[model samples]
Target: MTGDLVTGLRSALSIRFVNTGTGPCTDMVFTVGLPPGIVLLGGTDRVVLPVLAAGRTHVHELTLQARTPGPFDLVCTNFSYRDENHEPVRVTGWRAGLSVRAAPVVAPVPQPTGRLGVICETPNLVLGAWDELRILVINDAGIPLEDVMMAVTGPFSGAVPRSRISVLGPGMMARFTFQVNVAEAGRHVPLTARTTYTSGGAVTRTQVDHLTVAAQPPVPPSPPPSSVPQSILYLAANPRDLPPLRSDEEMRRVKERLQLARNRDRYRIEPALAVRFDDISQSLVDHQPAVVHFSGHGDRDGNLGIEDNDGRCTKVTPEGLAALFSLHSRTLRCVILNACYSERLAWQLAPHVGHVVGMRSAIGDPAAIEFSVGFYLGLFDGHPVPDAFARGRAHLLSRPGLAPEHQTPVLFPPGPSW
Candidate 1:
């Protein structure tokens, strides 16, 4: 006997009767005894065969439904038949256990209401950045919708979160955000968002959107020989709305540390103060610097604070920064986000830049300056990016009252020998 006896729902059990005698058998009867909590759905408890030919087999199947979750045994209580010699024979000893698991709770399907709508919102999609994809589910009917499900399918890098709404009232809508990362860049990347709900009956709505990925910025001509000595572009921003940062002091200390290095002639620092949002891209193009450093304010969400047109604080997201830096990957070797809560930004920039340094948590001005000095000192001594990051942390620990922030600085991609 064989069956899918171990299940949470309905199952099937089959019994096989084989005649191994040289001649045919007659008057064969078989009975199955079922344990408690198991019900025979549509089959009888016993089966009888009028005649069984020699070396032939017959199968009887029983449909069973488990009423409770437990282990139960199905046994064959009786098996009697007349052998070819007109002799009666009885056999017993057929038992099988069924382990029934508890059935999962399923929500009831909602009744159809009126109409359902799906809307997809896609901002500027950039290659190799975690971009946001927003989906809105709207109930246009006059009734409520229960168990609304939203799913998205696209050429994304990782898993996309599934959105669910238990109830959506009439004229109500729910918005969901999906962090999508795509590797390929093209003029049009197709994205589809599907939403299922009851609108009168089961209704499904699909919204398709084409996303255009921006290409990398073009590289500008090389700077003249006079600017060849300047390889590091230091950008500092202090907007009026946000708390003022000691970026000037940080820049000054960095210049002094680099000047004192044994190979000072091989490197030079170019400072851009009160950096505006637009100036970031222009500076990279004009200087074509090997190293780009930003000292400013960063929010917990990893948005860097930069100057707007009116000299007010403006925010730049990590995704935007990653896309912008990708354009300079040909010439840029490393990036240092010397601001608080920049660890996430560092990770985003790692794919494009060879090395990146960021702060794991909020850092005070003194620690930031000390780290910048130590990091530059290491670089001047021909230490690689990771080693220089360690040097920065060591400097922070050695400073008076700054030891607590020693682990604030973090390096991405641990090893970048260059």
Candidate 2:
């Protein structure tokens, strides 16, 4: 039975009883035990079936009324009747239990007089780790707010809290929380949040908050190197209908490039969630990678393409990308985005990560591959992120017959190296 039971309402339950005897039976009696909060309203627990023949069945229904919200049970404690030979027989039937919840409380939307207010309660500054950003949006205008969308840009990565809300009643408020991760330790990293919504058949957008990032105490020194090889996570997605990217060749080249680094004792590369977008976080948590690399297509508007369940291209917004990276900000030292127009993502990720590299504009396939190959090669050679990025660019520049369009990859916020 449906368990959303409201007080003072009647609920009905039906039970089936069957007899498999050689002849008809008589004096049928069935007793039910009901738990507290449920009372029999119209049906009796004991029922008389004057005659129940062989291979026959009977259905018994009970009507009950709930007194309050709680769990209730209907147990058949005893079933006694006479068999074909006039012998006494008894059987115990199954019990059914259900929980009831209080009716939901809904508040009406108030009318506003033209004031819309927003407040953000976030840490004054964050360093070298992830934190939460809580914001409250109030519908102070006289009209109701609909289709609200929020965007946050800062040194963080992941989904923005309450990115899209269906409605906000006038004078009512809604609270949203976002995860903020800081990759690099610094002072005064600027953050901006904005909200756009439809009100009274018109669209309006406003900047919600201006925040800052601060440096935290440096992380403790690493323990003596262990025998385990350092893992590098490489995530790639190329959905259907888009120009085919050479991801397979790219992975092969990545292994080849890392091998050339010849530091097998220290680093081992691993491919994660080849084309699955939902498994990205699970892969990160399972691997705890030191470096994270994403190879996919990116749009100028800050949406990165990842495959949906149907293998179709699905765009993940900049805020979502940033929020995802924040989860691994502690272990992730560097990130590489080998996709076209990923600079926006890089900036959003730079604060919570040690280093981030993204493309300034569209980059050709050949150039993108070379850049990734060179970057990993430099890393294996003990070069820092800046040096690795430079090496990648240099390798692209040196490629034979390299096109002029290949030099779009750029590193973000080039000062105070991590």
TM-score of 2: 0.50
**In candidate 1, where is summed lDDT lowest over 10 consecutive residues?**
209-218
Q: Model 2 scores what on Cα lDDT?
A: 0.75
Per-residue alpha-carbon lDDT of model 2 for 133-163, expressed as tens digits? 6556777676788887777776565554447
Give model 1's TM-score versus the native structure. Answer: 0.51
- TM-score of each model, paired residue for residue: 0.51, 0.50
Q: Which ten residues in a row have the lowest lDDT in candidate 2?
A: 119-128
Instruction: After superposing candidate 2 on the true structure, give the runs of residues whose Cα lies further than 4 Å from its correct spot.
Output: 1-209, 212-215, 415-418
